[model samples]
Target: MRILFGLAVLCAVVVTGISYFVLYRYVSDVPENKICGNIYIGNVNVSGRTKKEAKKLMEQHLKEDAALEITMKVGDKSAGATLEELGLAYKDIGKVVDKAVEYGKKGRLFTRYRQIKGLEKEKLVLNEGFVLDAEKTKAVIEERVEVLAEHAKDAGITKSADGFDITKEKKGETVDEKASAEMIRKYLNSGWDHKGFKVKMAVKTEEPSVKASDLESIKDELGSFSTDAGGGERWKNLKAGVDRINGSILMPGEELSVHDTTAPYDAEHGYVEAGSYENGQVVDSYGGGICQVSTTLYNAVLYAELEVLERYPHSMLVAYVDPSRDAAIAGDYLDLRFKNSYDTPIFIAAEIDSANQMRFTIYGKDTRADGRTVEYESETLTTEDYGVTYKENKEAELGSMQYAGSPHTGKTARLWKVVYENGAEVSRDVINNSTYEKSDQIVEVGTMSDNAEAAELVRKAIASQDKAAIEAAVAQAKGMSAAGSDNAGEEN
Candidate 1:
């Protein structure tokens, strides 16, 4: 019995010593001392190394990751962004080390012992966490993307000294920001698996709306009209409206909305307050005298025999057009619209030059006969006129008045769409019967004092029907009286 007991005690002491030593390894191999087996920091097995040794390995890998350059392949071209430029830095080094040491050391005594042994077979991978200057990276990517992007070209035409220069449409290409950002982030986190990695960038393309070939069918002058663009803001408004409609190519069966093209008029958009007909009187407003452009376009469209979708006449007569021939546009309320009813396309070529003349030339296929022609004849049906209007001016003499403008005669007129073949009228159709309101004569009467010289000048102007002479005389009289009154009021 004594011999058997001694063998059992000896076996227990040996077993105890083996357990204590195994447990000693588990307790001592901590992040403060050394990294245990089966631990990895982003695929770099940091097994069985001291704390100092593991840091050296991780720092070297981090530096490698930071030194890598990422190539962004865009189509046939490519650009690159380096980790140093992106401000890439590993931030969770300490945390990763702590976790690596803590692994397999938790749970009860038996569980801890089991895990320490198990770690030899079960590998633990802790990817290196990092932070980056996202804004800087984004800016770098955007700049490179912009350099690689191609802008689209919109269709346009400029009148050259020869015929006309046409611009063809071009497709636009750009980088998809979201996709590129994601791919770049993933590549950067790959632990610099590649020294200089090449990644395909995401790009998008867009097509232009119009093309030069769309207007190829426009080879002939279908119809045309022109009007005198009087000077000042009124002329500017007219020119602006015409320019907006110019170079516009209409596809077959498409309608052009004048309001949609030119609207939201303001001084900010190169428009000024000019004389415009509103209600029954003339007023100053933005895009004034724009009706002249629409009126001119209407006549051209009529001669071209294009389909008129919508049109409205002004309340009063416009000197540029006859009573029944005028077309008016008032914000979004009133609009003048037309359609390209033919199978071919049409181009509206409008211009205003140094001669102060505005012209709109419609270009399209003229299917009419060689001798066939169209004409617009405005016939006066009835005529009426109101007398005159007198307005007092504090600066002008009582008997002497300056003629602001002539009174417009109210009339009922019919616009006939007449077709002439072989120089003879073959058909006549009434297009519109417009009734215009009369505009009263306005004169600024002098309120300062009566002047016989100015009065005689007015009489002579009335007799000879000279408006320029009346205005000149009235201005001279007002100047003379103003000087005289100032002299009289001064101390003598």
Candidate 2:
């Protein structure tokens, strides 16, 4: 019996010692209930138990209390419990096995609890496509607040004053670059307070003007003139004329037509009726003698020796201007045009006066040698003749009287060649072949007296220039001659 009791005591002692060792281990491994001086439930003070036993106790305690449940009852619905709430859920009996297991899998239980506490304390920050940790979320919120403060400092949202002012309720000044950047930063960080965001911009205005030197150079060239005799009133007239030809700038290889520069024939513009030539007849019309200006300009162009593009003459011969000298225009129908032959600009000057005189002059850079000269020569090529026709006046008796008839109908082809050189022919060009028309003939029928009387009367009428007596005597003589010719033909 003594041996048995001793063995049993020894076994009991051994069992107690093993239990104490296990409890000590459990107590040593248990997390503290306070997280940085804040009370929590997951960390509990348990002693003399294994890890499995502590876990079973923790789970049993957590299941009993409504607040300690893994799922919390909110109204009639069950919602997921927060980490902080879960940490405080377990009873304060020994160590919390659930927390230990959870923490072991997810780092320190105390650290998780503290993080959840911090999340509950910090302001929420919502970012696009981002789920931030508690610390990061707090930092984001603080940064956004700072950005918004900076934007308020940089921004001026005051209303405009009256009129053009920018401080009244009617209008407001726009936000600037700094303010706009700050607002955008705030928007990206906090996803709240969006009243100050803006896209700012600036614009500048500019004015244009012509250079003084360019204007002066143009004026000098236009004012300068060559005043020789042929240069005569022509140059003066040209100077006066171009005074009105403003805004005309001719570029090299460009063509200019007189018709483009001249004002249209409108009575409102003070254009008067003047004599103009057309189809062999002279008539009065508005803007009539402007061709003189064209012709004069043509001459000046020749003097300047520019390139002639197109030129046409009056249909009939003109007395004021030579047959070949005149240039005619019928509004857009006809125009005298030329091209700037030089590699520079040329200004046209024209003048017309009450005397029906016109002159045209061109101003350009001088490009001629001292000894260089140009001359023109003309030659007749062919003459075209129209067959003659006779006209009789029924009111007068037949008569053998000849009167100075109207102008003849014929055509003359003239070759005008221009030679350019000092004395030798450097280049020769055929200008044109001109054609002219001839006039027609007409006869009057008159009565005749007796043959002897008619013969004497015809002779006297021819010598004395007596038209009436000649007609009477010719009528008498023609009757006798016709009767005699018929008799002679019968005898034959």
Candidate 3:
């Protein structure tokens, strides 16, 4: 019995010595300020290093991850942004390092020793938790995606000297904003284990609204109208306006603004000072004769049976077209707008003939029957007589007379569209109504005269509102001024 007890005591002492040695080794291997061995943070080995050193090493490794590039692609086109640009970052690197630092330095001595040994067999890799700002990620993703998108181009017809040139339509692509945002969110949150990655956006094809086939039906002439555009500086402006408007194609349900098409009427745009009517007097203004172009186009559009969205008549009556048939365009406000009411596209072909006639021909599929014909007629509703106005000129000698403005008769009228089928009148409808203002005849009479008698005679003639009387008085005053000048020379 004594021998057995001694043996058991010896075994117990040996076991205690072994345990004490292991405890001492564990204590020595793990420092108070350093992380234990076999520990990792995001693929970075933080073993046998202090908390500060481990944090630096892990941050360097994560810096590479943050700089990783992610590209959003559509076909061959691509746009890229970095993870850091997307506001991705480690949520709490310090807390993770603290946890790592206290890995084997917690609990009782034996438990701590056991944890250290366990780390030797298996690694304790602490995943650096990540966080991304929702707004930042979404905004970055959306901007990049928008830059990557392509716009669709419709097939259109451009007028050529030979005939017409048909351009092919280009296919376009666009992405769903919500889907793209979700896609980027999922990718960043998941384990993205790469330096760079390409994500194909969820794209959809956008087809052109007007295909080439739709414009094929625009061969026949639906309507043609012409007006005399006299030559000179005003004609130059008219030709420039026509050059801009020629070959314009109007798609179905599309409205064309004449002002928008031929605007910026300045010297740079090939316009010169010419005659234009303003407030009862012919005034010199830029883009003077462009109104004739719009008026001709208006007649053509009306004949084509197109819908006139907006049309404004001149403040005074124009000599080019009848009372209610003219359309005028001034600045941004007064514009001639018309829509292509047909199913097919409408092509505008404008040209200045050798006779100085501005003509506009509209081409589209003529759906009207062969025997059907249409015409427009202007009906006068009321008329006002024009008055005469005289202005005194101080610079003129004695009784000089000059015509300032022409007289215009004011009238209110309506345009009627008459349709005849098989040579019999079928319908007559009022298409548009217009009211024109009566403009006065302006005359400048000389009041600066040394002889009061001559000036008073001229004033009486002007007050009479008679052109013949004014002419006779002006002649008499001129004779008296010539006689007075002769007498003054003789006296000298």
Best by lDDT: 3
Comparing candidate 1 with candidate 3, which one achieves the higher TM-score? 3
Q: What are the Cα lDDT values of the candidates?
A: 0.77, 0.46, 0.85
Candidate 1's residue-wise lDDT over 281-312, tens digit each? Answer: 77899999888889888888887889999988
Tell me the alpha-carbon RMSD of every candidate: 12.9, 32.1, 12.1
Clash number for candidate 3 = 0
Rank candidates by TM-score, best first.
3, 1, 2
- Return the clash pairs for model 1, or none: 396-446, 396-447, 397-446
By summed lDDT, the worst window of 10 consecutive residues in model 1 runs over 456-465
Candidate 2 lDDT over residue span 206-253, tens digit each: 221222222222221222222221233233333333444423446578
Q: Which residue ranges in model 3 land beyond 4 Å of their true spot? A: 1-153, 158-164, 171-209, 450-492
User: Which has the better TM-score: candidate 1, or candidate 2?
Assistant: 1
Evaluate model 2: give its lDDT: 0.46
lDDT at position 34, candidate 2: 19
